[model samples]
Every structure is written in C-alpha cells, then in structure tokens.
Target chain A: MLSQLVFGAELAYGTMLYYLVLFLVLVLLIKVFAWKPINKMLNERTQQIVSDIDSAKQKHQEADSLAKQRQDELNKSHDEASTIITNAKQAGQKQQEQIVSDAQSDAQTIKDNAHKSIEQERQDVLANTKNDVANLSIEIASKIIQKELKANDQKALIDSYIEGLGKQNESR
Target chain B: MNDKISTFFLGGLTFNIGNMVAATVAAAIVLVIVVWLSRNLQVRPTSKKQAVLESIIDFSNTTTRGSMSDSDAASFKLYGFVLFVLIFVSNQLGLMLQVDVNGVTYVKSPTADPMFTMTLALFTIALSHYAGVKKLGFGGYFKNTYLEPFVFWFPLALFEEFSNFLTLGLRLFGVIYAGEILLKLVGGLAFSNGIVTIIGLAPIELIWQAFSIFLGAIQAYVFVTLTSVYINGKISAE
Candidate 1:
C-alpha cells in the first residue's frame, strides 16, 4: 500500500472537484446559520454594554448634583433660621429696654406731684394758726379794759366788747 | 497491505468513491454539529454547549489573528474554521473505525489520502495568491512574493512556493497515513494469537490510539495555522 501510494497511485481529480463543491456549500451554510447571526449578536452585546456604562455614569452625575442641591438648600434654611432667631432676640431686648425706661419716667412724675401737694398743705396750716393768734389777742385786750371801768358796769361792757370782737373777726 | 481503491469513471476523470463518501460524512458531521450548537444562541450565553461553540469560534479567530491583521483575519476566519473542523473530524474518523470489505477499504480517514490533502493545500496556496493580488496589484504581488530582498532570490522563492505546497499537503497525508498504518499493525497484534495477544497488546493498542488522537488534533491545528501564515505572508507588506 505504501509502495502504491508512492509510485502507482493515480491522482483523484473527481474527489478534488467534489471537495471543492462540498467546501463551498459548507461555507455558504455556515455563513447563513452560524457566522451572520453570531457576529451580529456579539456586536450588539458589546454596544449594549457600552451604552449601559454611559447611562450609569450619567445617572451617577445626576445623583451627585441632586445631593449637592439638597445640601445647599439645607444650609440656606439653617442660616435663615439662625437669622430669624437673632432678629427676634434683638427686638425682645429693645422692647425690654423701652418698658424699663417708661416705668422710670412714671415713677419720677409721681414723686414730683406728691411733693407739690405737701407744700400746699403746709402753707394753709400756717395761715390758719396766724389768724387764730390774732383773734385771741384782740379778745384779751378788750376784756381787761372793761374790768377797770366799773365793777357793775364792767360786766356789761365786757360782754359788749367781746360780742364786738366776735363780730369783727367774723367780718374780716 | 493491498491497495484497493474503489474507482468509477465519470467522463474522462476517475473518482475515488470511498474517500468521497468518507469526506462527505465528515463534512456533514461538522455541519450538523455547528448548526445545532449555533441555534438558540443568546447574547449572554448560559449553556455549556454554547460555551463550547463559542470557544471553537474563538480558537479559530485567535489562530487566524495570530498571523494576520484583524481586518484580514476577518475574511479568512471562516475558512480557517471550516478547514480545521473538517480536517480534525476526518483524521479521527478512521481511528474510530475502519471498514474493510474484502480488500477495499470502504471507510477511513479522508485526509490519509494524498489527493484530498493536496487539494486542500492547493486551494490554500491559490487563495493566498489571489488575496495577494487583490491586496497588492499583480506587479506588486509578483515583486513582493518572488523578488523581495534581492532579485537573485527569485529562483529560491519560486522553489519555496512549490515546496510549501508540497510539504503542507504531504505532511498531513504522511502523518495520518502512517498513523493509520501503525494502528492497523497494532490491531493485527490482537488477532495474531487469539486471547493472550489480545490481552497483552490491548494496552499498546489503547496507548497508540490515544497518541493518534492527539496527533490528529495537532495536525489540524498545524494545518490551520500554516494556512493563516501563508495568507498573511502574501497579504502583508515586508
């Protein structure tokens, strides 16, 4: 058999032709059944992965921005709240000072009015005492003079002088 | 060994029906398996079968791209894939079982014959030349392939082309043919003395069969690798 292969074996042209045809058919079949669809699928999967990664990155950026915005709002509100508290505290302090000042002025006015009324009362009391003294002297002098005129007539005279004195004091 | 090939004459050409049948069977097996594995394929593969299929395709792609640019590899990858599958299957077919009726072998490895391997080698070389011409014009192709480095190297380059074709085809034929012959010789040991020979030589036969399987796979790889290299040689610039 080896000798025949080396020396006596004739070339098989028909087998070659058959192989050519078979190989071509096989290529065509594989192209339709395997290569086309598989290659397409592979390319599609790659594209899908790329797009998914891109979308994920975009979403991550969006989340970061949103978080930053929320933090900014939170910070602003915190500042606003502190300002309001400070403003309220300042207004309360001002009101407290105004109340204290008003009370001080009211006390001063009360003290001045009390002093004026006391002075007026003291002056009235002095004038009344002077009138009482004056009346008492006049009565004493008239009584002494009547007593020396006559013992019997002196009583009548003394009574008349005292009456006059009383009248005079009433008219003045 | 008696050389008996079943021949039929069609027109002026003689065909080896046995080899044609065997080759066709091998091709059919490859086609069915490939088509089936390719069916219901998802973008995200889930099945072990799909993984196997993808690995096969990846193996072919990687092998081709090793010798050529990705752009060039794209066109020839299917060719490389088909060549590898067909050759691999054909090499293993005879090892599984060889059918002999009378003195003619009805079933064997199609690649063991000189005619089929030579045909494959011829196609590969011719396709390379065609691609070379397509990539570079005819004048450029000629100068690059034969007259490169020095004009004095033309004869040697020409001789190299012939030798490349001869070696590529004959190498496959020689290895497979010799392997099959050794297998037969080992198998003959079992039948020589009935039971004792069968028992003792069974291990030897088994070992040789395993080795032959390994050889077939290697030869398939070598063939595809060389095919890509040849194509790359022609298409790429110095």
Candidate 2:
C-alpha cells in the first residue's frame, strides 16, 4: 500500500512522484545546515568591517593632529627666519652708512691738509726771495767798494757812496 | 526519439539522452567559467569581470560565515560552490540548446527532470546526516532525533527524512518542468497562429516565461541556502 501510494502518479506513466519527497528532504537538510554557516560568516564580516572603519577613523584623527602641530612648528620657524633676515639687513645698512660717512670725513680732512701745505710753501718762497734780494745787494756793494779801493783810496771813498746808492737801488 | 527517451535502464527508470546531453553541456560551460574566473582572481579587484567574481566569492564567504560557526563555515565554501554550479547549469541547459529529432524538437531543462533533481536533493539530505553524525557521534545523532517528539515516535524521524527529500526535489522539478511545458505549449501556439497568436497570447507567454526564469533561479538559490542552513545546524550542534 505504501509503495502504491508513493509510486502513484496523477498523470501518465513514468512520473516518479516519490522523488519529490526526496527532494524536499534534501532542501530541508540544506536549510538547516548550509544556511547557518553563510549567515554566520556574513555577520562576522560585517562586524569586522565596522570595527576596521572605527579604527581607521581613530588613526586618521591622530594623524590629523600630528600634521597640524608640524604645520604650526613650520610656520613658527618661517616667522623667526623672516625676523632674523630683517635684523641682518638693518645692521648691514647701518654699517654701510657709517662707512660712507667715514670715507667723506677722510676726504675732507685730506683736502684741508693739502690746502695748508700749499699755503705754507707760498710763505716760505716769499721769505726766501726777500733774503736773496738782501744778499745780492750786500754782495754788489762790497764788490764795487773793493774795485775802487784798488784804483785809489779817494776814488774808493766815492765808490763807496756810489755803491751805497746802487745798494739802495737794488734794495728798492 | 520518444522511444529513445523512454528506453529502459536496469530498473524501470527511463533515461533521456537528449536531456543528459543538454545537462552535460550546461555543466561543462559552468566548469569552464569557474576555472576561467578563479584562475584570474587577483589580490586586488581589477576589471569589472574580476570584480564581479570577487564580489560573488566575498558574498559567499560572508554568507557561509554568517550561517555557520567559523569551523563549519570553512567547509561550507565547497558546498556552496557545488550548489551554485549545479543549479546554474541545470537552469541554463534548456535555454542554451535545442535538440531536434525528425519532426518533434525538444529542449529539456535539466532542472525539469525529476531524476536529476531528486538525486541532488538526496545527496544533500544524506550529507546532512553525515554532518550530524560527524558532529554528534552516531549515538548523539539518534538521541537528537528521538528527543524531538515522544520517544516511541522513532518512525516519524524516518518519515521526516522522506518528507524533506520529497519537498526539495518536487519544488524545483515541478516549477521548472511546468514552466518548460507552458513555454513549449505557448511557443507552439504562437508559431502556428503567427500574428493572431501574438495579438492574443504573446504578452501572457512573455510574462510567464520571464517569471519562470526568475522562479527557476530563486528556487535553486533557496534550495542551496536551505541546505547550507541544515548543514550548519547539524555540524554546529553541541
């Protein structure tokens, strides 16, 4: 009876309806066993991804702070460098001005010294000319007196007077 | 051709070569695709094809892990691959090929065959028992079965086994077979009637065909998914 019931077909012959039961059993078994693993794996994967994302976000936050601090330090260094450069430039400019002033002072002093030397030389020349003129007058008078004395003593006396006149002319 | 299909096996089983050929071709195509995709899998997804394959793998893995404990989930991968290949091939067989002998042409979808689907379902059910026995020794497996109802209802346990197998096989085979028959009937009518059939029945046939394809794929997925669930239940049980 069970065989008849199992083998019975509503349609034509060769219709194996018993296989339907076998198929259902297979599907039920799969539903209980295979599906569990797949679902378990999915849940685990989702959890893993969630945790990974959280950790990633945390790491990113940490890195962001470090970057900001480094940027600040860099900015500070840049500012310090600019200040140092500005100071150096100012000092250099001051030194250049001082050097220029010193050069001008030295030039002015040299010019004044040259003027004094030229004036001193002019005075010395004038004094030497006056001495030369006096010397020449004295020498010419003595020579004329000596020559007249050789000719005659009286002539020599007149010659002295003439010499004196010549001396006076030379002096003039 | 009909006589060829109805030829006697060792028992009363009728073997259809056309159906078997179509199934074999489909299976071959499935194997080739698996080899092609898996051979080229990369650490990092590249092309759309690779990405699609990787995503499928990833989805399967996640599903396996979610459905079973970590230990059982590892084994679930093989089962998933088998189920996927079997169903995909069976579903695509009729769609891909048409075999004609004399006047009557036949396109037998492998999933439409009760024998093929029944064998698959039986295999799954048997595997479930193996998993149960392996996880909970032979004694424990029997103990769980008895615990379900009154201890005297041991026979019901055997009945339950048959019931599961029946539903799994019939659910798939019935849907596929009926859908195939409907399509054939409608297609024959349309061809014979031409423009008049298109005006009257074409839309209905198209809708049914589309829905049947959807049902076919869904049934395969549901069957495998339930199988995995059962396996996980058996193996993971304390």
Best by DockQ: 1
- The reply for model 2, stretches above 4 Å from the true place, is A1-172, B1-14, B61-66, B103-107, B236-238
Q: What's model 1's TM-score?
A: 0.85
i-RMSD per candidate, Å: 1.3, 8.1
Please provide, for model 2 over B116-216, each residue's C-alpha lDDT reduced to its tens digit, 9 standing for 90 to 100.
67767777788888988988898878776545556777788778778888888778878877777777787778878678986788798878867876886
lDDT of 1 by residue, B53-103 (tens): 889989988886775878988899888888888899899999997877777
All candidates: TM-score: 0.85, 0.57
How would you encode candidate 1's per-residue C-alpha lDDT over A1-172 as one tens digit per residue? Answer: 6645572477878878988888889888988998887888789889999999999999999999999999999999999999999999999999999899888888878887788787777777678657766766666676575456668787787688678767866876
Question: Hey, what RMSD does candidate 1 come out at?
Answer: 5.5
- Candidate 2, residue B104: the lDDT equals 33
lDDT of 2 by residue, A1-172 (tens): 5533542221212223333333344334444444444345557767878999999999999999999999999999999999999999999999999999999999999989999898888888778767866776777688666665445766766677678768766885
> What local lDDT does model 1 show for residue B106?
67
